[model samples]
Target: MSAMTSAKELGPVRSLVPARLDRLPWTRFHWLVVVGLGVSWVLDGLEIQIVSQAGYQSTLGLSAAQVGAVGSVYLAGEVVGALFFGRITDRLGRRKLFIVTLGVYLVASGIGGLSFSLWFLLIFRFIAGMGIGGEYTAINSAIDELIPSRYRGRVDIAVNGTYWGGAAFGAAANLYLLSDHVPVDLGWRIGFFIGPVIGLIIIFLRRTIPESPRWLMTHGREEEAERTVTAIEQRAEAQGVKLTPVPESKALEVTPVVSVSYLRMAKVFFGDYPSRSFLGFSMMVTQAFLYNAIFFTYALVLQHFYGVPKAHTSYYFFPFALGNLLGPLLIGHLFDTIGRRKMILFTYGVSGVLLLGSAALFHAGLLNATTQTALWCVIFFLASAGASSAYLTVSEIFPLELRGQAISFFFAISQGAGGVVAPWLFGRLIGSGTDKTPLTWGYVIGAVIMIAGGLIAWFFGVDAERKSLEDIARPLSAVARGVPGEQSGPSEVTS
Candidate 1:
């Protein structure tokens, strides 16, 4: 271990690491950090799409029910992994957990490719889900902490949105990989390997990225945190970006407790910041319902209402995906420039309104398959960015000590409640009846739910744009908070 500053040497003094890190200009090092860690989402999307598409093949000789069971197993694994590993991330460090999780994913996914039977595949796939689920908590915490405040919003939103890009790529890849010329058994196995191959290359990139300096400070390694920030500064200066010194007044004094109890976290979450907790839960669950309900049942809607051929569903899907991907890429900066509350409200409210209109058009027998697809593309373009911001909201609103576990708690709740329920409810809505009334009513309910999320953001949202994490929500261990307008301690926190 590196030498650390002694608390006794300068009693009650503030550490400059967080301020220094937040004030630095963007550099090559920052980009490397983004790319290296951000690829986790891509790999996750690729792994999921490949399995969903190829799992039901006749070559596997599995019944449809058995294939569906595989998906449930993966989802259950993800929820378990997030809750279990998210706590580990808070106790251990981000760098260690992120690297370990990726290794687990690579090995488990690779082993999954070698599976010859349902039991074999189930075991490895569950392990792989655990890895990706762990990555969510670790990576999001690291990204928000390490990136400069000004760039954090857009970067985080864009990175989360890249999952769609991977899905699109997977969709295209399967078109060729699953073609009749390829044997079904061989093709499905190869599809599983795609993520592992990509992951191996990304592991090398992760090697170069440094541990978050903010995390170091809270762990009582103030000297090491200073050194890490200094190295980052030296690199930025070398890249021709002039570095400005952050004043000592910007520094924060914190009490370094090695661990926080779940009981304390619950108090902080529900008792101390009840409103913010509700806001996070509302955002997560609503987006999960809207996205999962629409995404999982979209093809069935197309086939039933538009009389569209099953074979042509993928072609329609490409445009919807392109809209989703482009939303964050195009509008992400607004989350920083315009501020979080406004952007969140706009994206969520507008998408909900648009969905209402789309629902009406469909009910009226006005939209054909082509127009309906186009309409969905426009609505989801806004919805995707809002959904991505829902993640950003939960990740940022909590104290640094609880960020990982907070993410895990909300993710598990949203996935368990909304994720599990949405598909089943939507499937029932799209029952064997030829009439589209039930599904249309489902759309109206989805719209209402989204609008409710928007209203919650309007009332309870934190305007976290372009502010340090400490500025948004003080670290649980922090002793002397620095934000000018904000109060320092948990008791004094604003709603």
Candidate 2:
């Protein structure tokens, strides 16, 4: 036998996994890491939640232009972080990137908490985006490995659900942290600080999170993978739990021989996989556009049209925030049960129709405060659910080698096309800028665009519900019109 195989044989069961996590909800090592990463996503969500509030804008003395710019600047940085760092994760490994990104987030958020100028906030916001961008590629991949394949879809949904929770968490924190004790022009700064602090705390906790064993196996590190799995098993055992399936088996195999030669991500990324790329990118764009159009503009809506008192405007958001948090949870079940194509299409279609209908109510002066808020609530909540799950679908439909790069590509490209633009357009329409439109038409425009996104998804997107990522994305070596793919196991490509 070759020295390499001989070396591998010396390692304890370095072949594969059903990773018995010792009869727990999560595999022994996974529970804490997933929880930590979820908290990261939540903090990410919370920061965004604070952006659109009147309290935020008023404190910063921001024009509509500035608000849009902040979102745009942040997204622009996200693009850099996502594209530059995502593929690097394959080379440098997941744990290193996770820790680095967390650091960036903490520093950005720390300075943002003390910002005196809007421009400084924008700069800090951009840095925060870098952290967020880096988090997705590393953390999601980390989560993918820690959990069993069966739990992927649900965990994917669950991870994203934290963003919704973050929204509420941020809003609530703002209500408490900023309550009665106003920061003279520092309310939003203080709001932005919360996430960074939490991210810093998690960094130390995240240190305990291991590198992906799957990744290690592929990289020709059998000893490391075996050692890592053993550590995980031992940890779980100490917790009075034994890994179910005993963590390793002879039946499963890791025959990968990846090297620098395998680094041509372009072929894997740019080949017939265009359909997957398109699906992923389109999902992010559509979701980002739909979300920012409303979320980043919500406070403006209340202040402009509803005639709600300024001091109490944050209170009005409690129900909406709660619904936003729950929307994904309520609707995410549909993804697994109903199938990807159907759930996304159905939710987006309904959300579009609702957005248009709500706009009509506002435009016609036909909506009373009660009716208006209720409709907005329903529409935004539904939109949030569908939009929230967009990343989950995108992330799951790519192969392991390129998954991080693929998601990062989408996050960057789509945000440029849509996400960063939505708020500016809304601001312009609302005349928050020097020239604004009536609030009524803003809703109409958002509704129309969303409907278009839904139709596009229904027509072109592939179904990912029952199939594993590899299976659904198979024949991805070539892109097609997305002709219905067969729901089969991932074509075993010997890596």
Candidate 3:
């Protein structure tokens, strides 16, 4: 579909770059962007999965409380990394930050493999979390900017959902790493290196992916943006995809600024788009709480409540991870087709309702480990797509100027508020011996939070499907002087 918009306020020279990029057919270039960027989530899943399982192993010698602290500390690092690098991503450009953040992860993960004590492990885990956190902001912004709007929803959801692919791989790796087949002390160290090993290979692939043209134009680099888009078009044509010419009328005229202060960005988000701010918060926090509560503590629940051996926990996790991976792969297209609001509401509502029902069965003591794992598979099958969409929502709904920062802001908030607390609380509950009552209530609470998020989406969600980012949320710098009834405000930044 053509992303042609009537000329609004004309204050400066405009380029049809966004519409041009969005109207292109899918090609090898698009796949390169998807694979190169999406692998960060998989690496994150592997890192978290390895730590979640290994912390319980005898060789690691971590107490239950200490293990929970590991999750909390890692989340803390994510919050810091997002805020710090997120700003840099906006200022310095996506390509630079993507390279830097991945380098940080590689070095940190390799060093983590050498940890002999809890504090040593904790420090590196935090550093690694920072890398993944920065990756979330930089990569999401790049993917959304680079991919055509028509394919954005499924691609984003599928890419985000690949985190579970790493989780499943981590779970499978733990089967051997935690087994008597390998030395207990050395196996855990090997687990830590898995992400870095895979990441080292992917770093080169990422180097081939270009910086965002939208970001380039917003930073007043029109020539570079043109070159980048030309290269992309050349790649598409080389791959035999017919290219459509972008119309001149689609160009947006604006004054591009070098920098926008965080304070002003905050005002733009909260002061002008309060409902969106709230919606982003609601989606992020609910998913963060539910995921951190269950995933980080799944091994403990199995060992305590179900009497599953530490070595066998990964077996349960693999199936659980598979369900999560499959969710977005199966239903992700609906976000673009059935529409964001309906699909998000459906996925969240169904997951929450199923979780509540599962909590009741868990309280009744009717579920064995197998049944419990099966139930989790069913619940998260719906939940994973919804969770992935939270990232999608934040990335797509905001203006390009603050896209990276907005992602970082909501990510930090969700992790700080929900991710940090859930693991510690759940860990304590699991540490309370064989009782399942506390954990049951935790599940119920998580369910309610998810349902509330769905309700918020139904009310406040933006209908951004198949729309250009500029159309969804007009660029901050876009002037609207001549258009009838169009008024420019402090928040309406010209880009």
Candidate 4:
């Protein structure tokens, strides 16, 4: 079906697309969505892990600060990319942006592998960050819209957590590549190729996944939305899954607008849903600061403090990555079952407290390399889930029409405020690797930030578990009783 050419021709549309999507049982199609779109996180993890390795400082003759600047530069790229592509993802469609963004990452990262100097590597790393940043907005938006409400929390968390799987893979690869087994210069360059090669496979897999029907219906492509949902229903039936009938009352009425101006979008974010805006900002910024500060400088800490050889840093990283990966996979279901507010609070609060305890132990001259890594494993096991939930929180709580842009805005803001600063600040704190005092204080600050984020979540977090997107936040385009200007409340529209 062709898209309606003029927004003037569009009218308030009553759609069962969201309901149909939310009611489907687990099927192979869902797995495809998980593997295909979710792999972007893995690529991001690989990039971060590889760049964080201590070998880069020696290989490129970069100072410790320069090594940390590598991460900061990349994060800056992510901020730019999220802001630039996020609006486009909402307007152009999730499928298109995801594919294009992945391609951008693949090409930029492939070129980065050949970098012979610090400036050269930083430039391509920035470009690669842009691609992955765009991927975060596009893929997260797509996953939330496509998955059933029953499984949305767990699936989104698990997918976001897959970043660690890529990190673990990078760590494992470095064990051999950064070792005496491979040439020093060749090892780091080869590491950059891993994500692109994996992405080549995933790009093909993503081709089989459909554009979001929820997005289609809200954007004046109602006929295409129907066809897309119908195809999905047929796929489920073919897999021997019994699909439930969607009641008419479950339908959402959306008045498709040509485009929501940025001015209007800003008002919706700051004016209409200020609390949710704060919630998103808190969750995103805290996680970004904590993760970026620690992960980006983890190898430096190991090499400088513990006398762990640059080649052996991955050994400790293996367990840390494993714990992060397992956190969401093991406990993500609680978000859907026990509830988002409680789970987020537990994860964030527990992790912060653990980090504080670990920092004390380190400060008192008690911990060796192995034990410090062990403590990180324990702390991040909870932190990882909380961080992943941060992504889930922002993606779901906003209106359907603004979902992509909402994620992008929060992500860009968080990265700009927290992510871009953390690595560079921590790098300076890790100055000369001689003073543990500065780095110890940095850890304390991270812990306090996370605890504060948890408190904000407890006070302001939306109880969005098992709720349809429309029910959580009515689309800006939605109207009540076919009245163009009247917005429907949750009670007025069921999904």
TM-score of each: 0.95, 0.80, 0.92, 0.93
RMSD of each: 3.2, 6.3, 4.7, 3.0
**Which residue runs of candidate 3 sit more than 4 Å off their true CA positions?**
1-11, 55-64, 428-436, 481-495
Instruction: Flag clash pairs in model 4.
Output: none
Residue 41 CA displacement from its true place in model 1, Å: 1.1
Tell me how candidate 4 scores on lDDT: 0.88
- Of the candidates shown, which would achieve the greatest TM-score relative to the real structure? 1
Encode model 3's per-residue lDDT on 137-232: one tens digit a residue.
999999999999999999999999999999888878887887788887888888888999999999999999999999888676778999999999
Instruction: State how far residue 33 of model 4 sits from its true place (Å).
Output: 0.2
**Best-fitting candidate, scored by lDDT:** 4
Q: Return the TM-score for candidate 2, rounded to 2 decimals.
A: 0.80
Tell me the deviation in Å of residue 317 in model 1: 1.4
lDDT for each residue of candidate 2 in 1-495, tens digit (9 for 90 to 100): 542353244332235432332123455466687777767678777777676553557666788667667767777777887877787785667888888888888898788777777888888888888888888877776776566555565567767767777877777777766666876466666777778777878888988888876667655566787788778778767888644464433223433433222334555555645555666666677777767777666666677666766666677677776676677767666777776677777777888898877777667677765676677678766777677567776666666656677678777777786776787777667764222236557767667767776776676676665453434554222112223221122342211
**Order of candidate numbers by TM-score, starting with the best:** 1, 4, 3, 2
Clashing pairs in 2: 20-243, 20-244, 22-242, 22-243, 22-244, 272-478, 272-479, 429-437, 431-436
Off by more than 4 A, model 4: 1-7, 54-66, 117-119, 430-438, 482-485, 488-495
Query: Which residue window of length 10 is worst by lDDT in model 1?
Result: 1-10
Per-residue C-alpha lDDT of model 1 across residues 113-218, encoded as one tens digit per residue: 8987888888988899899999999999999999999999999999999998888888777777787867766887788889989999999999888888888887
Task: State the displacement of the C-alpha of residue 444, model 2, in Å, after optimal TM-score superposition.
Answer: 4.6
- TM-score (C-alpha, index-matched) for candidate 1: 0.95
